[model samples]
Target chain A: MPKASAKKSAKPVEELSYEEALTELEGLVASLEDEQNPLEDSMRLFERGQALVAHCSALLESAQLKVQKLSGESLIPFEEESE
Target chain B: MQPTLFSSIHLTVSQLTLHIRKQLENDPTLQDVWVEGEISNLSRPASGHVYFTLKDKNASLRCMMWKPDAARLRVNLQDGMAIEAHGRITVYEPQGTYQLAVNLIQPKGEGALYQEFLRLKAMLESEGLFAPERKRPIHQLPNKIGIVTSQTGAALRDMLNTLRRRLPLAQVILAPSPVQGVEAPPALVKGIQLLNYQLPDVIIIARGGGSIEDLWAFNDERVVRAVAESKAPVICGVGHETDFTLCDFAADLRAPTPTAAAELATPITILDLSSDLLSARTRLTSLTLNLLAEQKAVISSFISRLKYISPERRIQSAYQHLDELSRRAFSALTHGIQIQISNVNGISKRLLSLNPEGILSRGYAIITRKDDHMVVSKVSQAFGKMKVRVSDGEFEVNRGLDTAAVIE
Candidate 1:
């Protein structure tokens, strides 16, 4: 758990991995949320945030619910009628 | 062959005893009774009837139970020992004496079955089957979920409904078993073993509330051992919230009810998570637009500096075009993530009217009187030849003298 931060510190927000996107996006959100920075800087960060979010969403969409149970063999889908 | 009753004013002893016996049999309250007391003066007659006096400190009652009822006695009864007896009260005909016709008897304190339950509990608990440190945390994103329970039980239905409502996408498969009676313990053990072979991310063993005997299967030593040894984390949702069993202790997690267990096992749906991404996308687009407007303001202010410095015009042009291209790309990306937003493009188009030059791009003209150089908002304000500004350049429009006055 402690190593998570050590690894994250080595990485930049723009080049974040899929698991780190949510945290980076949330941090960017908090930073930009006040509208304090000049428009150009905020805009640059916002585009980066968008790219990161899109990558994270793609990962989520790829996962599907996989169902299996013990039959005579180890684990098989429940829809198998012969069981 | 003894007696005939021929009485003018009174009944004989036998006739009176018969009347008492009939009264005792007719009373409904005495028909089926459960009495708790110490037994005394016990005797077994050759006829297979067991006779005993059931006595508390102050009172004693004669009890006689037939052989068939006596044969079913789960615990042996002896004189001067406390027992709970079930029987009906009846009066003997010849003696006119009332006695309890005993049907069932068990030791008064914690019957044999309950005693066995306590013994198993103590043994398992001493073996550290219930240690909290041994519990495994349930997996956060397990796709496959297994449940070991009777398929026909209400617990199964509740679990299914909860899983469907909270996260219909989570996969749940059942290993069916009987959750009650003497034969239930082994069935439950078999189900758990089968489920373990599959190694689901998590397993839930569930049953509805019942008496101690009904829940005995969950407390069975074999079932408890299986839960403790399984590679997958186990959740025991046996009986109601108040009900507790050894399985609950041995399993990795204990839930108050089956539905609560289901909710814990599944995570939120993908759609719910994607909505967050949608919101982030919106913020990104709006930020880009805000930056563009800010930079426009900054450049207009720097226009005065152009008199002192000759800026490199060629490089400046290329940079401006690159910024514009990036803006267009950002807008396209915004549209791709448009599932959560409706008519966002229309809003952006409306924002164009906020800038004076942008409205001209839509083929609208701004007219001003050349003499006063004041802008005209209404069409009626059009007087003599007016300077009308369209998108590209300026032009003069000639108006008739009565054009402004003709209406009024």
Candidate 2:
């Protein structure tokens, strides 16, 4: 049964950040609720939603690091990551 | 007089006391007392009685002024006054001490430190420093707000809280400064300068309530000038509702409290902005729809006009014109036939004028040879044996009978 399901599975080609995934999820929800899209587009959105959920779960597992610098004046080093 | 009182050994207590008070009141040496003193233990009771001790260089006297006499005094008595009092020295039997009962008082010199507050107020007013026309208008909605107050005071907390609740979008620049004491005025001026350099949209100078002396720093000329010269609009919220300062007059706007200043800085709510945006969108939609409707009407009218000049209608008009031309051609044919008939009649009359039958009636005859049935014009053609025909009948001619000269 697992080998039969693997042949039919559909996933996104590229990985997405948390914010990008959330934005795509919101757009997908809006498109599905619009009532103008056909059944084919609705199926595509359901498949994309599964990939976004997996990506969001991976981001939650990672811990963010914060660094502070003080030389009479205090400053916080910002993280470098693309949305 | 003492011997007379002594003689009356059985006198009543009231009579003896009256006689002794009269003797002391009449004494010239005890009538007036001059005291140069610093006042101590000064107590002004609610009943308008003043009880104080007046001390000189070496000694001090307990003094009491009743409500009536204290109220009548023109000068305000304070801790230190080198004064002279015009009254009799009296002894209180209970305390057993001689005290000066002040009747008329005069200051040795100007005693109570005269504040001259009105003088400074007049001087500032004369310079047109408090003119309402000179005041700048506060921004209706500031994008950035600068506050000049002590960082740890209640005024700062009130201002920050109010701003956070009312206008959270504004970027607040806190320029901390002392609000009281001698250093307060200079610190406030420096804060205003710093904010001016940064150029915030609005500045709010604020402090909590205190006594008159504590709030006097706001009246400093330097602070007032700093507020006046600031490029940004300044709002002065010094002390409570009752407290007014020179900075309040110099500022563009004055709020009763720090919280009120925050409210004044940002007047509109989110609902108002949203409503404005909605109205603009509605207007734009209506204008676009109207323009589209007008364009459609214009195109439709043009199309109708174009239909009038279409090729099919032009061809139909040409057909009607051809029918009218055919009718005119038929009329021309009838007129041509009549002209041709008249021409034929004229030719027939011309032919009749050349007729030989007509010529015979006019005494002319045509001659013809009988053999050939031809008309003869020459005699040579008719020989002796030939028969001739005249115009009316036939005749024979002989040559012998006609022996005449042959004319050439």
The candidate that wins on lDDT is 1
Candidate 2: lDDT over CA atoms? 0.67
lDDT of 2 by residue, B20-138 (tens): 66677788887776665777787898999787788877888878787888888755788776665556677665544556787666565422211444555677778887889988888
Give the poorly placed runs of model 2, Cα more than 4 Å off. Answer: A1-83, B1-116, B312-408
Every prediction's TM-score for the first chain? Answer: 0.54, 0.56
lDDT of 1 by residue, B208-282 (tens): 877556777888889899889888899999988887888998988999888888877865555665787788778
Per-prediction DockQ, in order? 0.25, 0.02
- C-alpha lDDT of residue B147 in model 2: 80
Model 2, span A52-82: residue lDDT tens = 6555545434412221111122233422222
Instruction: State how far residue A4 of model 1 sits from its true place (Å).
Output: 15
Candidate 1 CAPRI classification by DockQ:
acceptable
Off by over 4 Å in 1: A1-68, A74-83, B1-110, B181-183, B197-199, B267-308, B311-408
